[model samples]
Target chain A: MRRHTFTRFAEALPAAVLAACSGPQSPLDAGSDEAAGIAILSWVMFAAAGLILVAVLALAAAAARAPAEQPRWATREGWVVAAGLVFPIVMLSALLAWGLSITGGGGGASSPPAAFRIAVAGEQWWWRVTYLGPDGSALFSTANELRLPIGQRVEVDLTSADVIHSFWVPGLAGKLDMIPGHVNTLPLVAGRAGTWRGQCAEYCGGAHALMAFTVTALPAPDFERWMAAQAAPAAEPDNAEGRRGRALFLASGCGACHAVRGTPASGTIGPDLTHVGGRPTIGAGLLPTQRGTLAAWIVDPGHLKPEVRMPPFPVFRGEDLRALAAWLESLR
Target chain B: MRRTLVILGLLVALGAVGALLFAWSGLYNVAASVPHWPPTRWLIEFGLENSVETHARGIEVPPLDDPALVHAGLGHYEGACQPCHGAPGQPPNPLVRRMLPEPPYLPGQELRWSPAQLFWIVRHGLKYTGMPAWVAEHRDDEIWAMVAALLRLPELDDAGYRRLLASGARMPAGESARLLAAVGPAGEALVACARCHGLTGAGGGAGAFPALAGQSREYLMASLKAYALGTRASGFMQPVAGALDDEQMGRLADHYAAMPTPPVRPAPNAATERGRAIAERGLPERGIPACVTCHGGNALARNRLFPRLDGQHAFYLAQQLRLFAVGTRGGTAFAELMQATTHGLDEAEIRAVAAYYAARGRPR
Candidate 1:
């Protein structure tokens, strides 16, 4: 197959390229625009790197074959000036502008349609996600990970209580800060349906590095179903284990720090346990949200975050712990 | 060349002999009475502190939020900590003072610790310190609640403390009271603690629970967080504070801080007065840090991992000296740096130290 005129084919293209060119492309061939961009950028970067390497090899060959000369700092400076200063500044500015064209920030302008508002408050080592979406019909609240439809635009409001913090997702866009005293907004447009990793970029304190979450972009219907489930009021525990856990949680002052939309555990000092069972990890994604790990965290809280505000539950051992853990897990 | 070599050899031999003689002669007092020489003291302190700080830099900590974790911590505190540390308005047993480093007034946490620093100290108990590492094998959530409890403890009064302490103090207090507040608690934790910590912020102090009123907000706030997260190592508070949130902590801190700083009695002797001057004023001319720099940075923020010296138990401060020397009593990351300032002091100094701090005129 013939390559495009723009293709500086120093060598023949691959068999995959030959196959790809054999038929008219399908409508879904390239996936989303972001995926397309990623593919193109990867090729461009590889080509540029190959060309540079070849040029360097040629120069090295010439030098080896030719006579040696006294080293001059002037030549070094000129080369560095062109490659480091002139070339980088030009290339980076163009790339930055191009990136903005893809995801608007710093003069690039586009706002997420204010469909729903979620206020994310950063705590000692976890995230408290509160949905201010329309009451029962459109509301959604979850922790650690944030979910949205693949094609829809979402705005995240960020802020912290103790120190400076940042929000970042490697696959989507750049990092942004969640400073104290004021709120900041960032728009996210995920182009494909996949679970993208999100992490807290700023070092707020002792456990800064472990902070992580996911940006799950789902098909529209799945996303809607998730939202609806989230908005629905939390389940009232009736099963033996769950009833016991809820009672234990409240009796132990869990109500003092947390809130369950439908329950009497109405303290707002911590996360809303109204739907804790749905979360994959506890303690802001620090530990896996399994019964045993949950039990351990419930009992101590010290090993995980030293000097942490949460105290240990020494009194509950054996079945008391099991019943309480079972109850919290039932809050789904 | 021979002369040079001879001189070098003699110097080495003389140094070795000098060291041997010193060791054999019992010239250097290992007793707490005599302080280590300044240079040696600095080396030891630097090594210990630098090691801990450097090591702690890598551990990952997540943001704190766990309702269940906090709940469990509360129950743990009621059973384990109230006996020694006391609750809001509840004072610790006077006998605890007889043990080195008397248990601090639990509710007045502002003078206790910084959140992160507390975690580190808790994980690694100090040497020669009475403060024990947490009993729970994996103590993440419990620590956070203890922090929450510490924040809340300061505001609770005797009635409140008892209510929180009891395993069955529910709001409605009867069958068919199925408000979310009356959610099922199958085990010991199925009970409410607000009865003791108080619906309002007032906690116990005059009774079994130490009165949290007028204690350091900073200490109370940070210590609560530390205790919950197990950063502030304790038999109980770690679990209790672990169960709360920033709002509860704020509420607790505010409630207790608003209470009056307990009135101060005059020191029993002039020595205590002198100690007070040392703590408040410091030996600035002698390159000593003001005890208040860390302690009194902010009465509310005293929990920056520094226990409040003002109105603390004198005997407690003295025992803390031995712990601080060994690197145990839970402290902030910079706690070891605190040692250099103390290495120069004798046991007499340690006793005078607490007297001065404990004698601070009153909580403000």
Candidate 2:
């Protein structure tokens, strides 16, 4: 019975370890050139440490089993100097130099200059991402989700609206602190077109654990199309229910804190909803983007994400809430 | 000692049983015509006085010297108070005197209690007494106005009382209904409203009642329903609205909605410019939305549910905003949106916004 349990545990352990080491948010499962270098460095250090451990164990076993009278060379201080001092110094210096070369101070070690700039401000519990124009003026802003073209080096200017927050996407580059009143640039290059997860690495106040986002590396043409669509006004509702929802949204003063392009909702207190429907998730990636989730969020955001700033709207009822969610979903 | 203790215990038990039997034998008279025993009356009065003093202790009094406030209070007093608590030289109705613990006459009664005690008694009426609490508990501003007028009651004779109400464009309750009879059945229902809000629905000039004229029928109807349902907090409007049936409420809403907006005199104070800026641009950094977006500042078609604020009284607007800021001004479902938008505004900003709207003319 004990052997059977042990066998089962052994079988499950590797699978779990492998699974944990290869997610969209795992540094070992690299998707960018910079992250690949980090993965390689991690593996090299692991292998070197394992080898040293084995050598030490073997030497200790041999010493313990052997006679009390040891050889002159084994007992000499010169052996200690060669084994501990010289070996460690050379090995550490090599590792440090290699590491510095791979992860250049700004990362994107071998990539060309960044093609475009993206500014991401860490809010209380959400990421406010803005796509900047050539002259560095803000083109448009979105929240929670970020997208850039694959194979292009993108310079991301990270800052905070309130407190210090660390922006980290394990599959991309490395963690960087987003400090208030100061901007830190993180250069990232995505080698493959795929989605990656990013999280707040530092402890912010309430709802900090839920402050997460996503990075989608799109193809060049698709990325351009998305940018243009996001820049334009929201698409007009195609149905009567959608129109009613739009009227309610404006009349209920949702426009007071949120801006929908091409509408009277020019307020910038909350996230922009121009392309919110197209996003994969909402509420700082806390929920999947769907009609049901959107309606749930609108009616009771604090219920799902504690200490969230958005107030619940008890006013939206069955049909009204459904229509509003459906209309927002249709904005894509 | 044991024998003596037994006797005393038996005697106490016998006394308790005798008292219970005397009380339960339908012997105590609860009729209003029957006066209470002197000791019982003293005990009840003692409890009432202590309770009021304890509760009214922490209530901070606002400055009540404003004549406009006194004027507004007089208007309400004539409608809701005068019949029960008579003005100077005019005795209360003879029939009111027949009730047990009759309501007091008000000419010189203000001298007995401090303003805070008066406010407390008016806000939360004495239990088992004929006095009733204010219709809306959240409307402290209106209650303070009553206190302001109550403070002046001792100095006003019958002529002074009538003249003060007249200067505020208010009349007695019966006179209001008789004169508004030409407005049809809806006007008849608005007698109480007309006492404070004028005949054409123009508010008291210094901002007593809200201007209801030219408001959308939908908005007015919703507000009336909210007041009756106790969802909207207003001591003045709730009782008046609660007394009406749905049909009467509809008629009244239609009547008020159709009344032409009276010409407004622009009262541009120093804050008007700042108020105009906030109404138009808003302090976006603080997440305060421009007031005009929801309250109407453009020619664009807006939802009728949003009330017209173009010619609303500055005092009324400022009071409502203060209520919203403190999270007490309950209104229609849309009011929650204003709670969030106005949560961060300072008092100065609120007054400025009100002044801007008050000085604004009806949009063309």
Best DockQ goes to which candidate?
2
Expressed as tens digits, the lDDT of each residue in A19-63 for candidate 1 is 442221221123335445654555566566667665665565555
Give the chain B TM-score for each candidate: 0.40, 0.88
For candidate 2 chain A, the 10 contiguous residues with the lowest summed lDDT are A102-111
Location of the lowest summed lDDT over 10 successive residues in candidate 1 chain A: A21-30
The CA lDDT at A270 in model 1 is 57
TM-score of chain A of 1: 0.74
True contacts kept of each: 0.00, 0.41
Worst 10 residues of 1 chain B by lDDT: B183-192
- Show model 1 residue runs off by greater than 4 Å: A1-43, A57-61, A68-114, A134-141, A305-308, B1-364
lDDT of 2: 0.83
What TM-score, over all chains together, does every model reach? Answer: 0.44, 0.84
How big is the positional error of residue A305 in model 1, measured in Å on the Cα after superposition? 4.6
Pairs that collide, model 2 = none
lDDT of 2 by residue, A1-332 (tens): 64466456555754765666788689888888778888888878866876676577667656666887876668789999999899999999999899887656444454578899999999889999999999999999999988989999899999988789999999998899999889999988888989999999999999999999999999999999999988888999989999988877886767767889978787677899877899988999899999999999999899999978777888899999999999888878
